[model samples]
Target: MSRIARCSCGRLTVRCLGEPSRISLCHCHACQRRTGSAFGIAIFFARARVAVDGVYSTFTREAESGFLVSSHFCGACGSTVWWEPARMPDWIGIAYGAFAGTELPPPDQQVHVKQRLDWIRLDIPEK
Candidate 1:
């Protein structure tokens, strides 16, 4: 069965057609600014297997690598749904918060640790 995740507003639902390749905790400054948190959780999936429903809006930012990263969110509630990297056109990273009733495993990796807030301590090693 496909995994379905919806925005808090319930207006947007994303169907993930297969298991995620991995889950990550991103400490990138852009992610911190977007989420207004210490880190952002992302579930990686093959772009071909993911489908989104309902109207949504996206804000794009250029990554440090110079690739564009498009972040999708529910227009009504401003809840983030997913993101896609322009360079990795075949992959989609769904926001972990979208999985309302599901429990997320601990992040398998942490990226951009250098950008992490000094007050937040990440003792776990990245897988």
Candidate 2:
């Protein structure tokens, strides 16, 4: 079954043509900065299976792992919807926040915990 995610303004929509390969939380400072939150949730899917509609812009940055990652968002509302790693061009990472009705899956893992904010806590049983 396909899943649909859209920007807050509903101007940009992405159709997930297949199930996600992985779902996790990123605690890296760059992710925190990009999300303006303690961490970011990512759902990984094959690039070829994801279809995007409407206009969006991508901002590129180098990850701590030394791979370039591009964050894509709706140009009109500035709502980040997905990302893609330069090293893994065939895969895309959809932000959990983009899903409007679906329940988010539990994060499988947390990356870059070292860069987590001092006040943030990810002490949930599943984390």
Candidate 3:
């Protein structure tokens, strides 16, 4: 299946050509800060199966795992659309919220469980 994830202004977009390789709910503090929410859902796809378009800017940071992550956002609307992690050289992570108008699979797993908010509970396995 093909899915298009776009920025709020509809300028930047990532086109995913098939089912995502994995989807996870991330509860790390960085994720919380980035999303301005309790957590962030990351939808991952193989680099070969994804295509990005539109003018964008990137912010690169070191992840908790010690690898650098480059997050791409729409230049016009400042919405984060996707990211590339040094730890996962061949996969790109898209913000699940960017695919706003479509139905997506529930998160396959949860990460940084120890950092998860006490009020949040999910049936998915933790990693």
The all-Cα superposition gives candidate 2 an RMSD in Å to the true structure of 2.2
Candidate 3's displacement at residue 47, Å, is: 0.3
For candidate 2, write residues 1-127 as lDDT tens digits: 7998899999999999767888878888787887888898898989989999999998998888899998899999999999999898888999898986896677777777777668877753334
**What tens-digit string does per-residue lDDT give for candidate 1 at 1-127?**
4788888889999999867888899888888887788888899999889999999999998998899999899999989899998998999999887887875667778888888788887765654
Alpha carbon lDDT at 72, candidate 2: 90
Candidate that beats the other on lDDT, 1 or 3, i.e. the better one: 3
The local distance difference test score of model 3 is: 0.96
List TM-score per model, in order.
Answer: 0.90, 0.89, 0.98
Write down the RMSD of candidate 3 (Cα, Å). 0.6
What tens-digit string does per-residue lDDT give for candidate 3 at 9-66? 9999899998999999999999999999999999999999999889999999999999
Alpha-carbon RMSD of each model: 1.6, 2.2, 0.6
Task: Supply the TM-score for candidate 2.
Answer: 0.89
**Candidate 2: deviation at residue 82, Å?**
0.9
Residue 20 displacement in candidate 3 (angstroms): 0.5
**Stretches of candidate 1 exceeding 4 Å from the true structure:** none
